[model samples]
Target: MQLQKKTRSGSFNILGISIKLSIVILIFFGVVFLLNKVDFPSPKKTIEKIIPNENFKIVK
Candidate 1:
């Protein structure tokens, strides 16, 4: 008796795409968070400079 080969299908593609998208989203958010945290003049300071109204003060 001969063994039959298993065929691959679209499920693999869907899983691969989902995982890749998740990783890209995670990395993007991580970079954004890091940028907000690392002050070369920080996110808060930049926002304050851009909109220097008393109402727009950093709420933190």
Candidate 2:
């Protein structure tokens, strides 16, 4: 009766919140991936800089 109706509505609200959170997570990861692909270079360069020179020694 009344309890059933409330449960249904609550389920829908929970579903909507889940969808929104998932979208936000996806967008955050997408932006990170795009930035990485673009050679944004912050994290990558920082790691490279921290490593010893032998680690970056030219292969050719």
Question: TM-score: which candidate is best?
Answer: 1
For candidate 1, lDDT tens digit of each residue in 12-54?
6778789999999999999999998886943555433465477
Residues 1-60, model 2: lDDT tens digits: 355434344335778789999999999999998987885535545433466677676767
Error of 2 at 41 (Å): 7.2
Q: Among all windows of ten consecutive residues in candidate 2, which has the lowest summed lDDT?
A: 3-12
Off by over 4 Å in 2: 1-12, 40-60
Q: How accurate is candidate 2 locally (lDDT)?
A: 0.75
Worst 10 residues of 1 by lDDT: 41-50
Residue 59 miss distance in model 2 (angstroms): 46
* TM-score against native, each model: 0.47, 0.46
